[model samples]
Target chain A: MENRNGCKLVDLPESTRRKDRFSFTLLVVIIVLIPVLVESKYYLIVLNIIGLNTIVVVGLNLLIGFAGQISLGHAAFFGLGSYFSGILTANYGFPHWPAMVVAMLATGAIAYLIGYPALKLRGHYLVMATLGFGIIINILMGELEQFTGGHDGLIGIPPLSVGGLTFDNDLKNFYLIWAFVFFCMLVARNLLDSRVGRALRAIHGSEVAANSLGVNTSSYKVKVFVLSAMFASVSGSLYAHYITFISPSTYDFYYSIQVVTMVIVGGMGSLWGSLFGAAILSFISEALHVAKQYHIIAYGVFLSLILIFLPEGVLVGIQHFYQSKKLQRLIAVKTPFLLWFNRF
Target chain B: MSNSDSILELVNVSINFGGLQAINRLSFQVESGQIFALIGPNGAGKTTAINMITGIYPPAEGEIYFEGQVLSGKKPYQVTRMGIARTFQNIQVFQNMTVRENVMVGLHTRSRSEFVRCLLHTPMVRKEERMIRRRCNEILEFMGLASKAGLLAAGLPYGDQKKVEIARTLATEPRLLLLDEPAAGLNLQETHEMSHTILMIRETGVTVLLVAHNMDLVMGISDTITVLNYGEKIADGSPAEIQNSDKVVAAYLGREPW
Candidate 1:
């Protein structure tokens, strides 16, 4: 993909000389090994939860990582998808596929409602508005005893199946879920490499500069916000169908915090990093089950340390570290090509 | 080019922020393909005028026309789409982005790839991106930044950072480019080099309307000059005529150039 003058994907520094499909290659290898790697259903199911979170993180990465906007109520959108799909299929006798689609559209409308005008103005209003939305949704879920099954939650949601193949078991659900995860990874990767994603990254740098360069900053922001919510909604639908049970607690402020933590820990603005963030956080929280009393403190300490040392997130920090070392070694070896710039 | 062929016009434009008039009844004409310079001291509303022209803020009292279309009340990106591009005074390069990526941002309006095509990574999108990168490299080469195109813009030296800003704006392929203090922090040698680049840019048939405090650079390259004092145009004329204007000398130059 490198041009004759030695430029590749403009934003990618590592694979500039190469085609830069490293993420895709990594994705293919991971998808092929999950069944072989995990023996127990508990681990497989835990991995599935991580897959669902990964989807949310992928969308959030575009909004928060690339566009530099934060949302504190992603879990509310997740809840919308879960409840909308669950109620339609389980209670209303709708087909699973159509229910999912309807749920997605409904969630999209809600996202538009929140993102359009709420995202119009810049700064902390978005944070406050999303926070307010999360709390309000949480309250509504508790109060709508007839629709949501109230605090007790809902059950009997149908499992997803296509062409008579059902994902009723953990192994079946594993492939079903990871397929979406990697598909999302592919889409997210393609997007970041494109002009639309570049515009988002530009806004992240400085919106004033991006605007002068002909970027509609507010439009991009709203679109990313909508896209992020849609991803969360999809994950929610998947969650409801897989478990056939969901409560308001599943989409509370605490869960929203968990999603944001995943983005920050894995690395913002990276698809692979989102997967890592979700997987690592899920594994840590599950592994600390025996140390239940100290789990929250340990998790906080872990995330804080990562943020302290690698403020850009894990993946970017690693890349930066690796590149700096290579640069130091090259500088030590010879003054090299960049030294020629001194003449200017 | 015809002497009276104006590419951009600010017609009695005025704007205020909380009762402080940033620009007041400012009017000027930039003839097509000409190198026009706006010169004044700090707080004389030069940057505010640039902001108004670029659609950062709508003129509260009048209109701005680019190519005979009213530019007032349009979005910033819309104005940019109409062939106007600009650089910020305080070097606003996407610091974390490499020089190539920064220019790619400037090439955004020029890209015609659809969202689905980009999401699928289709050949058309790939081909379009390659074209943009090629054009970006040429701009970098023109700015003498080709050697450092792979480096992060924030990591570059101050003088080189300024060049990168201009390079990014050039990538937009603007019919009319506004440069705000392109040589503000440069040394004498860098200023000379920047003035050379500005002249070369003008030679490419892209009109340049610049705001700079460096009187020497302004007087040397500007085809026409407009002096602003306290949000008002004090004088507008050819560079030779401006260099001799008593009001310009008394207000802006404050001394004889010779």
Candidate 2:
């Protein structure tokens, strides 16, 4: 009891805290009810895809958004996860769960190896280094014929299951993928509210300031990079298992760019923004699937508009707009004649 | 010999940036519990010396000893954990973070929990968070920023932002606090409050090393003053002695009494 009392954070009034709690519960309810509300098979597939992107973006948010590290090779880790898991489950006859775990571990190990040296490079140099890594991995995925089937890709990957339930269909797989998505979100939120999150954001703000506050900025950067890679790896494993097919082209440089776009569009430094970014971009991509030739151009236009109009993020933009509207309403009510003059 | 009473000593430290000397063979000692001031003009290298002492820059020559341990090759985080904390010259607050969280971050060194513990948010992590948060609250109240704890640090007014910076540093519970221009953009009343806060901090036995271009604040409260000009120490003495020094006048003062 005494320890609990000592641990009481948030000196806020009870009303504000309760309001926050209500909003959070409402958000959780909405996320849980997403599948129930949407029924089209295509939409279901797209939602699953968005969930996969969300898991990756949430981790990327921790790195690029909070820790201020850019990654242009996130797709490499994603591809690695898919390839590793696919080979283990399909060729080596390993269980789905253990294969996914191994893939995640492999991605984490490789990220640590590459991140230790690569993180020392800053700005465009770091971007170039990561881009090179992605291209190398993409090449290896295509050239490795014996294990990965080269350009033909490995096929007939098994579905993931737990105990007695198998996620064998799009709807079932939707549940599986979203389960992981929410779990990742929970983990991200926990990290964002803790000392580690603060240190990472401090590093983003100013590495010098973070170091002067006793944060090991270099090591933290590497750690977050590895963590984000593991997130990508898990998402990749989910992708390979769901699609039951994966070629090197599935995880290309363009995919990495899309991941970064999702982070930027959703808003940096926010979990909700990551989800929104993934959903909006995935919707846009799928909706324009009929006009495949113009998809890239349309994505370019969308990204440009988002960058130019709401660089802070779509969620933040909406919030700002709402707040201004509320302020306008308050002014109109307080001064009736002023509202008439402001009608123009 | 390294004096047991003095907490920090700089033995002829020097640094050069692209052939331009940023700090030149500067030697100074700060007593264990006194408000020591480092005063200089625009380009006098006071902040550079502080940066070197805090491990942001490695000295090209000489040595910095903190409580008898050499600071050479030590990282900034290492220096911080060794009981030194610093504020920045250009207000490097985490623009996106809240004020309370800013202060809580300073307690990163004091936490003993591993990543697993933090990620899991176990009882131990909770206790640590509570303790750190409570201390942050107390620091904010002391700095007159308790009401602004929930606001984004960048959203605060200039004077309050400076106070938030100091409050965050104080959360480290440093034996030696390095404040870089705590009153740079502050008005007169805020500066008065800041000096009072500095006195209270000294009363609590936390030694201070302040870098400021403002001489009035320096002379009013500083137990000792080191005047710098052209990256070199011009005078080191009591404020009155510094005020009377001819070299300090010709280089730093230029016949101005204020």
Candidate 3:
């Protein structure tokens, strides 16, 4: 329930802090226990991909849910990160860690340049801009042969390593990827709870109102765009290293659509919804393998269903469902007393 | 050219929408601590004038000076930082946010911590956030919406939503506040409450400039009234003076002989 008093921070419920703590604790327990319980490399790999996707979806949610801006080209940013990190480390012999950082910064810079102009004008300009940008980058990834290794794809991307240890197998990479996922979620949560977060939600709620209140809406929009892009870049780099291979197809339009679907299905504005979205969608896609050619259609159907029934996404939808069920029970209990009182 | 007490001065300001002029040669001075009203029939460019003042649309001619700084090219947020804040005629409160969060947005210009600091939850940012929470509470309490702080703004009644918008603007600690129709859809009681709120805001030393169609509200509280018609100012004086002025009376109702 909400605080209802002016004493606490606005909009944030009293249990939110406790709930977040509990969720984080639960996540840690799951992360630590999953590998031991599952014992299958295939499942671990799937879980790792979900973790990587979670990071990007969470970042995308900030732009989509908080700023009410959409990017159909995030897959391009994802590609850029993979190609940058993969090409730099595998081809140029750069260290893996620095390559990842460089990839993120470069992606952030690119997002800024794109966001600065696109964000100035209101409405669906961003959607069009990102759509065009994603296609161009995906083309460049294939067309550039020497650097990217062409359609043959970039190979031999080194798994991340510390001084003496390396994440080469599925289980090790699982820990590595999910570790990043956990950290990314924490960062996103922090941003959401702070002043910047509120400014972002305000921009989403109404850009005019946000501007009137001294929010540099354009700048903040661009900043969040860059931040989300950087998040995608990190996930992309992890994806490249874990898979030990990179290709333009991996960051194609469908992948972008998939993650966007995840954002909506999980809950547009909910952080944990991003996780559930990525997990559920990724699992569905994997499970739909028998329908190979029809999987995209299946995704379309699933997306339509979610939009129709759970427009707020799965997280908030479930919340409303739970709340209403509780309310119904309370009313049912109170009806008998009301009927008796009516006779008087 | 304005005296030291002039908080905002519009000088020969005009704007055009394509070939049509929305406001023409309009000039007014709101002195410090005055409750000024700009009243006119619909489509008289009252909102357009407010837009120009708040830097939503720059005047095509002349300048708007806030504390002697030219506001022609400054962005809306820049005008806010310069201590000029405004509310929309149609309420523009952040519907998804809580009433307190809406007010917290008012502190955007005042609070210094940004993305990195807020993400890290740095000592300085935490300190600033604490200060912001305290200030938001004070604002909500002052506006008597403290009990509704945690409620989503979209869920509040229309009158309370109006108060939430004003409370949010107050959080900006603005020197000059432009309220566009502060009492538009309100009942008599709500309008009375709004007038009291405006007077209270003025008592705190903030200059109030409102655009309203409600003659009772404009007459009841305004220290000065400026009447506009067809994008031109027809009369300017105290409420009583404007009420008695032939031009002001003609603008509201057509000539009796006609």
Candidate topping DockQ: 3
Clash-forming residue pairs, model 3: none
**Candidate 3 residue A41 C-alpha distance from true site, Å:** 1.2
DockQ of 3: 0.59
What is the C-alpha DockQ of each candidate? 0.46, 0.46, 0.59
Write model 1 residue lDDT over A1-344, tens digit each, in one string: 43455643334533642444765677778777978988998999899999999999998888899999999999998999899999888888899888888888888788888888887887767888899998999889888988888999988998999998998999999888999898887788778878988899999999999988989898888877887888888899999999999899888898898899999998988777899999999998899888878887888899899989998888878878878978779787777566776778
Question: For model 1, what is the alpha-carbon lDDT of residue B173?
Answer: 83
lDDT per residue, candidate 3, B80-116, as tens digits? 9999999998999899999988999998888998898
Give all candidates' CA lDDT scores: 0.87, 0.87, 0.91
lDDT minimum window of 10 residues, candidate 2 chain B:
B112-121
| TM-score (all chains, Cα) for each model | 0.92, 0.92, 0.96
Candidate 3 chain A has its poorest 10 consecutive residues by lDDT at A1-10
User: Regarding DockQ, does 1 or 3 come out ahead?
Assistant: 3
**Candidate 2, residues B17-136: lDDT per residue as tens digits?**
998998888999999999999998889998888899988889999999999999977889999999999998899887777887788888888786655566677898888888877677
Q: After superposition, how far is residue A127 of candidate 3 from its true place, in Å?
A: 1.0
For model 1, the stretches where C-alpha displacement exceeds 4 angstroms are A1-20, A324-344, B1-4, B253-258
Better of 1 and 3 by TM-score: 3
Residue A209, candidate 3: how far off, in angstroms?
0.8
| Docking quality band of candidate 3, CAPRI definitions | medium
Candidate 2 residue-wise lDDT, A1-344, digit = tens: 12322444345423443664575677678767877898888888998999999999998888889888889999999999999999999999999898999999999999998898887766545577779999999999999889999999999998888889988998999888988887787777767677888899899887888989999888988898999999999999999999999999988999999999999999988778999999999999988898879989999999999999999899978878777978779876879777777998
